[model samples]
Target: MTHQVHLGIALERAGWHPAAWREPSAHARALTSPAYWRDLLRTADDAGLALATIEDALSLPDRFEPVDALRPGRVRGRLDAVLIASYAAPLTRRIGLIPTVTTTHTEPFHVATGIQTLDFASRGRAGVRLVAGASAAERANFGRRDIGVDVFPASGRVEDSPEILAAFREAGEFADVLARLWDSWQDDAIIRDLESGRFLDADRVHRIEFEGEFFSITGASIVPRSPQGRPLLTVLAHQTVPFRLAAEHADLVYVTPHDDADVVAIRDDLDAAADDLRRDREPLRVFADLLVLVEDTAVAARDASQRLDEWAGEPLTSDARVVVGTPADVVDAVRELAASGVDGVRLRPARQPADVVAIAEKVAPILRSAGVLREDADGASLRTRLGLTRPESRYVGEKVAL
Candidate 1:
């Protein structure tokens, strides 16, 4: 059977391009409004896309410059990603809402409960993209740990810095705590029995008591076991440190592979890491990230990309491979990626609503017809849709000795 590739959208304020806000079709004035996110998410859901990952950060997009000296052209400001996902949940039924949550500054307990609440709200359609906040501004916002100014060096290689690597290591521990907390409450822990006036079975809840280099949690989660046992854990990895983190903790790993060979190489690295780590569970899923600008024709797409680049004062540059073409071109690209062994592709649109509409109306139908994209199964949870089984709680069989 041909492997059906999962499709997702990485939603930014207006779009991924720095100058996307200047576009006539961009919702520049309403970036924080509920209607803007609602429309975009509804489009993705209706398009039968598998998931939508909301981008977030504690600091503004421009990390280097002072807030007062920030450039005027780029878009700025965003509401809380978890809150946005919760707001969009009722409005969208099918697509998984995976919001980015920075683990460096935020406490693991808060992250665990917040995502648990989101999972409950979305009825198991929620996931979180784990990220480590590295900027001094973001660190200042929390007034927590002090990181060196040169954590992100001139070479643009993040893993080269020990501080950054340590942050990722902390994030891995953060992910571990989140998972343990999610499994703290057994599935049947809650029982509303009027006869005995019993609200919960105390025996069924387990204290995780997780102690690590970054965090130490000593009890069961305040929140009950979520619908999927644990919502999906995801990480966007570009190098070895993050690749190992994803292999060890993430259910899904998003990778920036510039070409087919890159895809194969990344897959090999992930597999090797998983092997070295002695991962005993199901292998994590890999999704290649693409920054896309699709139009009616190749010329139209190129023209649109050029226009955006001109507006931005530079050509579009992304960690992911940039694709500019028509629906057929996109389909061919997806087909190639599938052949290259990627389980999915997360497309970051260069423009809002316009590229979103194109992906839904034009691109998706062609892929579905080609057997590359599968139709969404009605009423399926995000895990079910992704072919992941709902895991039983680790504390299920552990009963309190009388």
Candidate 2:
């Protein structure tokens, strides 16, 4: 294949629009409402998107250095991502519904079980987006003991650099342990044998007693092995070391390519990591994420961009690298990113349903003509559509290479 592409949408809380709640199409009710998420997933699935992520996030008040901005505190958001996906599961057929769950506060036991439930409810189409936040406001929602800022390594950490390298190592190890916990149960352990009056095969289950500097999680899961063995594990990484996590673990990795040139660097780095880790499994699927406002004309898109910036409390700065252009221009950017060695993209719409639908109608056709989209996208389960194999039912055996 020349390239592979999968479309995914993250239902960001209110989607970067302060006035989104006031908009007619925007949900005025709870974001946690089943109906609201169901509609969004249905729309995205109908439009050929592969995944619709119901991302749960505890928003830290947007820290403002200036005196006049909205003071930092807990912002508006309250929804459990895993539960939302579970509820949305029976509502959609083809689209994979992965929800965000933080490893920061959530236990591997609970998180692993939740994803397994999602896989069952959706008939094996569930994935999890794992994110770790270091903000005090977000930590407040967890309400355990206080996890000070130093608990997580500071940003810009390097081997010989300023930030605490140990902290990054700790967090990375925790994530690895979380993934292992998700697989602790053997697939066949959950044999429902009413005839024999026996419930499960205990010997098949493995207990993991992983003890690390930052954490020490013990043994087998309360839930049976998931249908997917492990649902698609996705992680977002902005820098080099973080990207290494994706290289070793993630089925999908989302990164922002600074330019066409940057795509090469990201791909090369990931490839090197895979080789270093000796992971000769599937080919790595790297995807570029861009916030975009597509319009009939470049100027029209620019106008929409400016409006969003105004809502963001300032003109959009260089910090958020968003694509603002006509469909043709946006197509060019996507094509370039794909050529720079990526499987696909997770396009962030600058606006609401309009931009999303517009991209599907306009930009997608261009990609189709370019032959980047996969042919198997039609008439397949999310796994089959992604060109991934259907895993053995949660009652199988495996060899673990230590």
Candidate 3:
């Protein structure tokens, strides 16, 4: 297959737009249904998309707080992202399944093994999106420690307060621990030698003594080496700390750039951060996140967006760029971002199934025609597909070549 732009879809309950559920095609009550998630993954797989991210949080949807007194068609609840991915893994093929998880209140040991389990479940087509918790309500759900939202700044910069910097620093260390734990067991550790009566080589497993200001752990992960060796690490970031975290650990990062200049700036920052850290791994794959309202024609797409906005009684905006256009127009917009060195685009559909179908049936064909999308997944692991090598176990001593 020729070189092409990567494509992933961020799947949330109902859709991204607050008013999306008001759309005729929205499944307002199917947010927690296993069948709903399964069908969604199947649809994405059929489209030959690279991956799909299941959005999750520690708490209920804060957008609809006081859940009983919510809007008519708002999505209220969410199933566990990790569980959803695992449930749908066997039911789908090709597309990678990435679940969002908050690293703040969760254990790195649990995060490592959980994602490793996902990689096994999905046959190496698994990843996790690490997000730092930024809500007081979310903290209450954990009750683990007091992580105030004030720790994160309004500017998304780290140079301001020690608390914010500490949070990011903790996040960075957390990511490091996850990676180390993932490599704690060597690939050939599982001997399964019946004659020797050894299921694994004890020496192959190493302990990871990770001690940080926020969290500490001493032990290797309970889960064995997964199919991917180390599953892909992903983060969505808009600023320096997160960008640095992504550069240091993430195989892929989702960024939202407002314009070509923003794209250039973000890419430059990523490169600089990687260089500053002396990261020798492959360049981080940067995918732009866009909220897309796609239809057969640009006019229709605009109408759709406006109608959704009308339902919400206000104009809609987002942290990510929101594009309302035909499938071809959407492709053009993505190509423009790609020109600015973006590796791919992760489309957040404004409405489920309908907008997703537009992406798969319409936008994907256009990308394929332009030699920018592969016709099939080619049975490659998600990390392989993303051009990442199977990472060597850090626990293993380096073998010297004669």
Candidate 4:
């Protein structure tokens, strides 16, 4: 049997289509409100989606909708990925929640613990998609000295400059530290033997004294015993070093591709990296990221894309675009991608209601009927959903001489 592909939709309250907000089916205020997310999660759950990825960013919507005219960088957003998972936890029973977090602004200690909390809070249905801070704009938001949007922003700088490679290395190191710290507490540490008034077996907890060029964090999280142990470590890599980081640390990686050729090349890169790392990254699910704008008809969707581009004061993206199409068309693209070593596709619709509802109602069913999607959501936590087993902590029994 062919390995079945999974379907995941990134939620932004509205659907993924840019004109989706204008569509009668979309809800206006939900894009920036918690209630909006809750409603959508339920929609995905009802549609039986495998996962819902919530994007965490300081800036949002890029533009606005009549529903809720967002003054980009002004209107506060709904709760971020972790909180979204917590909010959706009780409402929907399945649907793995993967939230994107920037390793640049946050300390590994904080993220490591918070993700673990999600696992516990959501009953082991938490995953964090890690992305290196790429924009000077984003860096500025966090008050960090950042780089511009161009690839490897400082690649040719003659003076002291942080290149893209360095940024990824730093982010990789950050993930490394998070993994180590997560394992710093052993699984059996929670021996609540109240008879002796000892809540924890101290011998089970390990300390990680990780010191890298970028950072050093002492081991042992304030919160211990996460349900999934490591939850799910994922990184979206569009370049080399980040790709390598995914090979080393990420259980699931999201890759960007211009087309089929790009997808094949990335698959080859990951295969080579897996060989170098002596890790089985081959079956390491690579999910293609697409900014979608699905519509009832291709022509209408195309025109809508054009209109949205005009609104943004620029043309729709030339590359990495999953333009207007029907559910069958989207499935064809998804099937081709899966054959090219993509385990799935994560869609970011310029939307709130239409794209998401369509994905769940239309795309997911098409994928399922085509024998490509998971048949059911039972026995699926974020880890198992991505096919990763429990990870062994780097701090299990070693003491660094440093």
Highest TM-score against the true fold, candidate = 1
The digit string of per-residue lDDT tens for model 4 on 257-342 reads 87888987888888778777736533567788777667778887777777766655565552355646777777777777777767
Which pairs clash in the backbone of model 4?
14-351, 14-352, 14-353, 15-351, 15-352, 15-353, 16-349, 16-350, 17-350, 208-219
**Would you list the rank order by lDDT, best first?**
1, 3, 4, 2
Question: For model 4, what is the error of residue 6's alpha carbon versus the real structure, in angstroms, after optimal superposition?
Answer: 1.0
Model 2 misplaced regions, further than 4 Å: 1-4, 17-32, 60-75, 143-147, 150-167, 317-320, 377-381, 389-402
Rank order by TM-score, top first? 1, 3, 4, 2
TM-score result, candidate 1: 0.96
Residue 347 accuracy (lDDT) in model 2:
77
Q: Cα lDDT for residue 53, model 2?
A: 68
- The root-mean-square deviation over C-alpha atoms between each candidate and the true structure, in angstroms, is 1.8, 4.1, 3.4, 4.5
lDDT by residue for model 2 (368-392), tens? 7778655554445556666666544
lDDT of 1 at 215: 88
Candidate 1's displacement at residue 378, Å, is 1.2
Q: At residue 125, give the lDDT of candidate 1.
A: 97
Count clashing residue pairs per candidate. Answer: 0, 6, 0, 10
Error of 1 at 206 (Å): 1.5
TM-score attained by model 4: 0.86
Error of 4 at 400 (Å): 11
lDDT, candidate 4, equals 0.71
